[model samples]
Target: MKRIVVLLAFALTSCSYFEKQVPNEQELLQKELKAINWNQVDEYPSIAECEKLTDATQRKQCFFEFLSSTIQQKLDTDTLSVLYPELDTIEVKITVNPDATLVFEPQFPQDSTAYDKKKIDSILRVRLTDLPKINPAIKRGIPVKTQFILPVIIRGE
Candidate 1:
């Protein structure tokens, strides 16, 4: 009985050790995209062609096309008109805290007359584990700070 119990424990431990390390879908997609160089253009692939891409790099590009479509659908004529009342552009700086916490601040428009001050602090929060899978700088419980500048252009309707 003692030998049988020990054998069972060893088997379970060994199985845990051999658990395969598989990359998540999103991480895989990011890797594939990073591996390739893509040229940016005003026009993008059609929905049907995008859905057909199987290669990691191609699929990533396709996904971007899908995202743009979704955004267009969400922003109707009225919302777009208000958000972009004139031919104006603004730049925003997003800062992420080093301690694995999220921190976002928007740089107000210089004129303060083009767009509203409405901005969300965190559009999406990725989990700690997820970060490691994408960016090498990210780790479990490690503090990191990052800054990003985004220019939003609004064309008059």
Candidate 2:
């Protein structure tokens, strides 16, 4: 009975030696965060037409090309080029919000005094308001906002 009691006690104590310590919630979360790459997204933003593409590079290219063409077409209908004949190309900063809203801001050169910036901005706002539905970019399966600068050519004709 004494030997059995000693063996049982030794067995119970030895079990702890093989047991591994589990990391706490905070530690686990920190580890996961470190593993993620914040600079690059898993998927770029897309429209319904570009969504049919399976390749990442192809989809991104399609989205940018479509956006540039759409912006050019919309602005062509307006008097932007006629008002600012000196400006042949304008670099517009496009922001794609996580909620799928778009914001367009025209970037002008430091010495650009020939054009009225406020008037140009207002025209852009009106022309760009009725764009097709956009799907926001995805990072780690979560929707994220993205911004890119697109140079749009102004048709002088």
Candidate 3:
């Protein structure tokens, strides 16, 4: 009985010597990152004019509205209307670069004759260049490039 007790005590004492392994700095950092909420952004990127707004939702809305209106104003649909009076709609995607540069890409049409891309891009580039510098998107307070999908509706009336 005394031998069994000594063996059990020795086993229990040995267990204490086998300390739990500690994770490395990288592993700890990875665990912390995994615990973070990626879906939530503390603040959104906004134009200089909208920097004053504190609410994230309002700031985002203001940014989008301002961008859309500016693009709409720059669109010279007058000539296009004359060419294709029945032209209905054109889909385009705009990407905002980290440096606040604007890139417009018009969706290619299945029928070539149905639209003119080079002319549209030239006009777009000129207009975009003439406009003021835009603000880039923000993720975790860092500037990030973002894309905006827009539909350009062309109507004669």
User: Which candidate achieves the best lDDT against the true structure?
Assistant: 2
TM-score of each: 0.31, 0.87, 0.68
Runs off by more than 4 Å, candidate 2: 1-11
Superior candidate under TM-score, 1 versus 3 = 3
RMSD to the hidden true structure, all candidates? 15.0, 2.6, 6.9
Residue-level lDDT of model 1, residues 40-115, one tens digit each, is: 3222222355546666467546644543343333333324346455524444463445443433344665787544
Worst 10 residues of 3 by lDDT: 72-81
Give per-residue CA lDDT, model 2, range 1-157, as digits (tens).
9999999999999998999988999999999999999888899999999999999999999999999999999989889878878788999999999999999999998997888999999999999998999999999889999999999998888
Q: Per-model C-alpha lDDT, please?
A: 0.45, 0.93, 0.73
Ranking by lDDT: 2, 3, 1
- Alpha-carbon RMSD, candidate 1: 15.0
Q: Number of clashes in every candidate structure? A: 2, 0, 0
| Top TM-score hit | 2
State how far residue 115 of model 2 sits from its true place (Å).
1.9
Question: Which residue pairs clash within candidate 2?
Answer: none
List pairs with backbone clashes in candidate 3.
none
